[model samples]
Target: MIATLIKLLIGLLLWVGLAIVAARIVFALPRVQDRIDSTALDPADVGPLAATLRVRARGQEGKTGIAMLRDGADAFAARIMLADAATASIDAQYYIWHDDLTGYLLLDALARAAERGVRVRLLLDDNGTSRLDAELAELDAHPNAEVRLYNPFNLRRFKLASYAFDFFRLNRRMHNKSFTIDGRVTILGGRNIGDGYFGTGPAALYVDLDALAVGRVVPEVSADFDRYWAAPCVHPVGPILGQARRDGAIEDGLAHYADDPQLEEYLEILEGSEIVTRLSAGDLDLEWTEAALISDSPAKGEGAARREDLLSARLLKAVARIESRFDGISPYFVPGRAGARAFKALRKRGVSVRMLTNSLEATDVLPVHAGYTSKRGTLLRRGVKLYELRRKSASRTPADTLGRFGSSGASLHAKTFAVDGKRIFVGSFNFDPRSTMLNTEMGLLIESAAFAGNLHDAFDRELDGLAWRVEMDGLKTVWIDPESGEVTRDEPGTTFARRVVLRVIGWLPVEWLL
Candidate 1:
């Protein structure tokens, strides 16, 4: 009888544990939805708005050079802001806005706009800024600037357990970048705000990329921002600020940070870039062409309510369109068998697919390479053009810190693709399971012969100089280990165990969750 009682107790405990987990999952969703819904704004009609916001370029014609591709971060930011100022309203969003020197400068600019009543709305991912609650409150104090966090961890309610319990929520991040100004011009691509993004870091500056669009497409970017603002993912600053109850504490803190020397220098460097001057004058010269605004969210096509998000749907569309040539560059590429198969299909259709991704030695996430290496055979078999970027030569000198500071140990973090040398895409969508199935992503598809040609030339330069071209051998192929810079013939015995392990783990299908 005692034994029976013990068994019953054990079973009851197990059931309760399961119940708690399920309850927690259910509890988290509404909180996420409430935050997303609060900031929702009506999507403005961008066509009529575009003309009013469009600023014609004037004054000195700047020197156009191929080297401008490596323009510094300060230059990029300043240029975009100048393009944005021509707008009637500006909407900017990102995952991280650091508290460092660069962060304050950008914040100050936004604050100035708010003071001018530029109708500025800034949406930031909560996980990246969770620790900066106090800092955010100060920025929000800008009368025209309203800042909100997407799926924030409510420090007041959740408290000590919040960090631990909020892991799941933290995983589904909003990895989108869009800056729409005056409802006319937009810059959409894979940059976040920080020293790392702007080349002002102590480490190497990343070879990142962004796109400038002017015409019918800016509105689509605006619509996506409005959707997220109103979605259940974003939460207002009121509740968290109210909980902190620091009152004017945030505003004062922002003022102090805004005056820091690092920020002042960063801003100065930015304003001095030729690109900044050109963009400020609204002088982007290009023929208007086809473009599409793509956004990824757990709530994808069916919108935010459904269980499966639309990131994959948009990706598949991009892939299907790649029925011709598949040219891609992603910071992270862990192509599983499924991803390999997709590439294979393109190859079968006689598409010349070339990809450039980070080397394992340069990759920040080693485990992702573990997944990528396992699938190289499939990619090579499909005749896809594959290349991995080497760490830039240490002997190379600095070009211009127009993008960001720091240039010693940078790795590639760009997510871009060009199809048929006509259509191109750039944004936060990495070619990995996380981007496909978990985190919400965003990118802009630009159909511009001019822009596409420019990007194609850039890709060629990287292919010839910075990338290690992957090629096939007889029955086997060649694998180049980045760390060693040694080429080894791919035979039966090369890391076979590692391949087996990856196959087993990848077969589980939970990597998308990971």
Candidate 2:
């Protein structure tokens, strides 16, 4: 009977192996199918918005006009206003476009722009758009609109199954986020298209940052969008999902949002907000600054990207320019052993390094908190200052008036760092192994002391009321509440079960993946 059981186990293993092999073969078949390729339109006569940008950018030939979008409500309004103001084209790409209220709002806005004859190109990473087939199809059905999915999975319903068979390829993702309009203005930052990122939905909202830019960097963003659009991995949704019927979902969705009394307050905020109106009128209060765009090559999506072509490599060069101070905020900050060493090196050079990340109870991804905890002690011992944003009730606080890029009672989702109080980098880059080695990322490296000073000021003043300073107490880790000076030995705001999960996860050899 034992011999029979052993034989049966062997047979089961053989069948499982065969099934994986068959799945791989099936996945390969869809990859070879042809898809459409396109590029951004030339901005010779991009109408009123382009003219307004040109007039505003007349003196600063090389500088980009930038306005910081610190509030979530303002961020949502800026995108909608850009869609309304664009006369020529609108290009947008994001990792996550949830099938929720804010997602539909933005989709409806984009669809409306396409209806007005403004070309709209939407590219989304397939991993994030799992249940939005019909919505994407609605926009794609419009004459001037097109949608593409990056590194898509063939399995429509069971996309995770594709990962089981082809984990290596699907593991890497396009985490880049940008929105460009009329080839003259753009907004690039950490926020994704979801109710959570914006100030809506059931969950607590994110305190995020986006730079509304014009002048030299606008074309640079447009060009980058074109490169990602024409990449080998992109598949046109029209061919993959078929020419989806033009159900009036997008139109009716916008109408619902307009009539919904709950969103009326937000609508009033948008109507009263002056950024987009100023953008159209060419007189927004913009800091003119020298900036350069840095991004990973599209090849990173396929694990074939070269070291020099990566955002990590370029980011290293930027950090090397740091002579005095470094202040940063990253939501998922999983600095492994090597990263801790890098921070140690920075400390050796007398750079005042400070970081603010999500506390264990505040982080959305539990495993990432474990990844950070693994290196927490090493960083503290090396003289680096660490602060963890604490969770609170979702109510308006002093931070609401302090230009807190992240609000009180919000998760830390913004990824940004300032160097030497004169240069700052902002976009969708977390200081983790995944961002360094797997995902394609992008951001702006700006030579603006004022902007960098804002980040430094947060560490010096604003965070005192908003974050807990983490310290090493012998072999025990302790958190000191910034506002109350209360001490805690345990991970604040997390339950016993959550702590167990982190402990179990930390024991696994998965730091690189985190």
| Candidate 2, backbone clash total | 1
Each prediction's number of clashing residue pairs: 34, 1
Please provide TM-scores, in order, for all candidate models, with all chains considered together. 0.77, 0.94
User: Which digits, one per residue and each the tens of the lDDT, describe model 2 over residues 1-514?
Assistant: 9999999999999998898899888666355355566778776366667777778878898898888787777888899888888888999999999876778878988988898999999999999997788889888888899999888886877888788777888899999999988888889999899877876545577767777788888888888888899888887887677667658866665566675664675677678878788877877889998888989888999888899989999878865666889888888998898889889988998989999888876778888999998888889999989998777722332342224433346777888898888988889999999999998899988888888887887688747567779999999889997667789998897788887888899899998898
Q: Which 10 successive residues of model 1 have the least lDDT summed?
A: 59-68
Clashing pairs in 2: 207-406
Best by TM-score: 2
CA deviation > 4 Å runs, candidate 1: 1-70, 74-76, 79-88, 154-169, 243-265, 280-282, 301-311, 315-324, 394-406, 455-462, 471-510
Superposition-based RMSD of candidate 1 using all C-alpha atoms, in angstroms: 6.3
Candidate 2 ranges with C-alpha deviation above 4 Å: 1-13, 27-36, 44-46, 252-259, 393-408
Judge candidate 1 at residue 492 and give its lDDT. 21
